[model samples]
Target: MIKNMKWLLLVSLTFVACNNDDSDTPAEVPVVAGSAVFTKYIALGDSFAAGYSDGALFAKGQSNSYANILSQQFAAAGGGAFTTPLMLDNIGGFSSGGLQVPKFPTRLTFIGATSSPANVPGVSATPITTHLTGTFSNLGVPGAKSFHLIAPGYGNLAGVFATPATANPYFARFASSATTSVLADAVAQTPTFFSLFIGGNDVLGYATNGGVPTSQDPVLGDDITPTATFNFAYNTLVTTLTANGAKGVVANLPYITTLPHFTTVPYNPLTAKSIGKNNDAVGLATIKLLNAQLYGPLKQALTALGAGDRINLLSETSTSPLLIKDETLPNLGAQLAAIFAPTLGAQTAGAYGAIFGQARQAKTTDLILLTTKDAIGTAPTAANSGLGIAPAFPLNAFGISFPLQDKHVLIPTEIAEIKTATDAYNVIIAAAAEAKGLAFVDTRSVLAQLSNGGFRFGNFTMTSSYAVGGAFSLDGVHPSARGYGLIANIFIDAINAKYGSTLRHVDLALYPIQYPLTIQ
Candidate 1:
């Protein structure tokens, strides 16, 4: 009986070993057959995907984005040419060390223009001018919102680069007001593979507004992409792409506040010391509270201020008062002075305006704030200075930026809020990508790392410091072409890893910055 029991135990062990061996046997996992399944690639998204920046949409920036770069690799592997909204012309090249970039039109502000609207050319038209030849593959649109992709006949809509009514001579030669947009065109194309990068511009408009509570000011209009809307549009877009038998990649939004434009101009809280009032003058806090109303949650706080606090709020934007020009803030500081003066008396108001002007003119400690830091540079004094106002930095010169305008202090709360919103947006992006089986590229972290020092990309060092051969543009918000390339690589690596594609990596050495050769 003992002998039979030992034999039974040995047989049971042998059976278990055999089962383990079978489980360990290599299974025939299917490889993605025919790279051509991904051959007919279509790209859809906003400016980052389109590589729009530096005030002009151009081929160089457009071609360098990861989508285009990936498409190039796909084509080399027998894919098709990527179709994009290539800028028609007047794209200014990079500045030294890539620190200063000339805005579109070189001189005109987004707010200020001449009596006659300047003619600006548009992207290519269909057939002869457009991408209908079936040779085209990329479909990137600048200023495109997530839902805009599906909007009826959006491509043919005017006011993108030019308006048809203006008979805008500039666009007459190049505008394709009749051409189909990325959404309609890509859907019509029926690509086997696609890339979707939309919804960035949605939140961007609000962040640019300084994070004011849209709930209180309906006129302010909610600038962020409503979460529900984003979900609906994004789901529909993805469903359509997948249902069409196309496999594609999607990217999340980049942090808005990280750009050089936002970072370079900081508002220092301490400089509030330079501004104060006595029994004769209104308190500086009133000026501050009022100015803060134009942005952020401070408007609620301003409403609570007493009439005795009637002194004009010194704006952190211009270091003067908030002014409205026909309901819109004008490009000039004089406009703010005119509208914001307390009804003390004509003399007092004039005196206030003069003092406001002095603050506007003050370089040592007068603070200026704007709906955008971009406006700060255009302040009359800095415009006349020949040398633009230096961006404010933290006193420690470490990474933390303390907002300042010509040494004057500005509030830190709104800026901090902007950064917080950016972080939150990026987090949403990351979570969404993970849930949807997509790759999330943390551009904020990547940029911060580079700016804090620099990052290594295939032996190349990419820094974020302005014009220091770093990756940022002059506005400090947008990246240099090289910077964009770095961005492309970040997305590319993520896509490659998630999808198992061995696409060629970006060649950073080929792209060079044009501004501040050294940070010091």
Candidate 2:
């Protein structure tokens, strides 16, 4: 009986070993061959699709592009090869006649130990001779507007070099012919799958220009692509792209105002204590004296008009409002001139007119662009030096004697116009996506979440905050490689849900949060 029990125990041990082997090597999850065919994938859009980062486009940036990332995953699932009009070097600027003349500045890099950043030039310039051959897969043009994709001669090299309005230089480099349109080139490929995210530039130009309307006429160009125009163009693109039974995903525009370009600098950055050694009574006394001498009469005039609070006295220990151009302050230059004419004389008063002519306090709704931070306290140009009351004062420096221009600050009215256009465009995008049965990515919601707290992907977290955000690149508008990886995952999720494709998501940690000056 003991021998029988020993044999039974050995049989039990053998059964357990077999079970462990099955658990250790579970059947490989069968790669679900999704409904959509990704044999020939193509991408279409503006700078974001083109992998524009650090204020310029280069080879590394293009390699890590979200479209490229998606294509890699597609390849794993039996997709074909993907190609881009790759720039020659990591140094973003291109060379002309063997001499580098960068149209835009280089990428941003953290200077020393401080959070402050500086624009660093690329390591090498791409020669003009470096051009791609044959039809390419990634057809993203850096600055193409919605209407521009269909506009013929947009890639004409002659027009690009002569008149920017007539053609786009970035497109000119790779265009099949001078008369080829972006949409036509994209369609000629006969793609099995495509990704498009356009229309950002349509409203972005207006917002960046401080809501300065380009033109009321839609055909005039540089203006916000009218809602009707966007709808027509977008629908046509979808119709043409899907005419051959190709599947695609489309992303809507985010609120441009929320970008770090507008959010980095606060509206009220100036405080009496922060400006200089003003924490002491002596410093306070000097500031008061200066205010009384220069801004006293003007303060009284604003008080009479029921805008006394708008007059920012330099004596206050708390934060002071930013100086801005208020068009509603009727005849402001003349009013300020009249106030100073008696003491400073007509010639000096005339100079004051040029100084305080459009000056007003920036409101809570005002957005100070990131680019304006550097110009805040610098001296004015030589021509405008005489505008100061004395050598002790200079009117050219921002906040000192010069008020912020309309271009530097987006006022409340301008903010309203941007919001209106954004909302209208989003509605059109959603409707088109639904009608076409295409995947839609709500980029606005994603950006909003990033701004509110942060976004989490795998083991990493990213925010929309300037340099530290680990999402946006040095430009503060475009995303870093890691950020693009996050975007690729988002697109993958949407694509999977719509097309029934089980595309694998990318690991954000693989891509760097901050791209180095040298391409790795």
Candidate 3:
């Protein structure tokens, strides 16, 4: 089934590429009025449409946004003025309680063959009070989901501090009213053309949070948006936007797990050499001694069950498989505590059980998030030194004693759930585009290309690799300026085919592959 699915996707992508090819050039081509209207273009979606990069929404990133690039091309083909809710400065941030609060770090800079964080302070000079007013064309909110477009009070400033989930700071800075809906605000402009690239955040939140739901309610907060709810909301959005006879383009969701944020780190990062030992025997022996003390008689049982192989003996190694939460493991802790109760006393045995009970070695299928890189070899704080599991031996102090928290790793089961949700959402988006007769952009195929081989645009090549990929910025999830420029050309191909317009594609080489850490 998987092989067949891959073949079908490949064929679909080939069809799209062939359609986009303008090889049979028209000499002295006559101007043609396309079937669709392009007098006013309004883009509506999340961070990608907003041109958010390096983990922040700043002026330079917004200027190079895909929507802005598309609008510029549209102008030559009879489109009108395009505007965005621009940030005050290149150093992106927001304000809280009338004081500047830096939301994201500055853009990354390449220094001497390495990508490092620029020496910029966290605080931004611009406050959220510096608002840009007027019915703007770009309606892309950075963290918006599919349902958020129809949700009222999503832009309420009062809800910013009181109820963050109910309010969006980006929209609050420019929403027409406290109770205004994102969809309603976009519709009020009566746009002649629009582009919708939502649904990424619907499943992205689950992946980014290491597949843990924020609340008990799976449909709310940082869980996957229910498929039924997504269908209803998506259908309504397309229906309302096209009710006035405006033509547009809609992009499908890509697999968020494939991005560098989740793929950069490998699963089996530990080895004998990494532990500063000459042989695997030395490392294995050291880990066995620690395990015997930590688990007692349960140590043999764990080895028999292959748990010993997963435990990294290396101490303070930068690259190591993160010890993670494994609730599926047998109640070895309880059994061990009972076995050692007579000699060690109940309290001491129980302490040992609490420390090693729920912990296990992360598997190859599991993914340790990029954020875990900093905390991997670091020492645990006083509050987290539970029972001093490795008090005698400091080498086992890092991950063996201090297990990586649930938020740092995506277990195999969580990965399966994310894949399921992403597939279901893509189906809904494709069906909606077909029903509305709107041009559909298969972003999944594009992302697959970026992940596997690498996408070539004009004279440059880009991939989903971290830092040096040239496609993604420091944040890993969002695109760099050059990446957005390539995306603009993809949209142009779909638009020209659907509307029968000869819209010229943008020159991607004009955009910079990497933005300097500071404004130069």
TM-scores for all candidates: the values are 0.57, 0.88, 0.84
Report the C-alpha lDDT of model 2 over 1-520, residue by residue, as the tens digit: 9999999999999889888857677676554438778889999988889998878788888888999999998987778999899887776756677656555445567656756676665444665434455888888888777778787888776775553247776777788888988889989989988999998888777777666666522222446777888888888888889999998899988998999988988888776554544465654564576577656666776666566766667646666677777655655667666766898898778777666666777777889888778767665555433343422463435654467767677888777778888899889889888988889999998999989988886666799998888888877788888888878988998988997878888888888877775556
> For candidate 2, what is the TM-score?
0.88
lDDT per residue, candidate 3, 159-203, as tens digits?
A: 665533467778887889989988999899998999999988888
Candidate number of the best TM-score? 2
| After superposition, candidate 3 runs with Cα above 4 Å error | 1-33, 97-99, 102-119, 216-220, 271-299, 304-320, 339-345, 382-400
Error of 2 at 173 (Å): 1.5
Residue 381 displacement in candidate 1 (angstroms): 12
**In model 2, where do residues sit more than 4 Å from their true spots?**
1-29, 111-115, 122-124, 128-130, 213-222, 272-274, 277-286, 382-394
> Which of candidates 2 and 3 reaches a greater lDDT?
2
> Candidate 3: deviation at residue 378, Å?
1.7
CA error at residue 169 for candidate 2, angstroms: 1.6
Q: 1 or 2: which has the higher TM-score?
A: 2
**Per-residue accuracy of model 1 over 39-153 as CA lDDT, tens digit each:** 6777777656666544444555566665777776665455666665454333322222323232223211122343211212222222112322232455565555666665544
Tell me which of candidates 1 and 3 scores higher on lDDT: 3
Error of 2 at 307 (Å): 2.5
Worst 10 residues of 2 by lDDT: 383-392
What's the CA error at residue 131 for candidate 2, in Å? Answer: 3.9
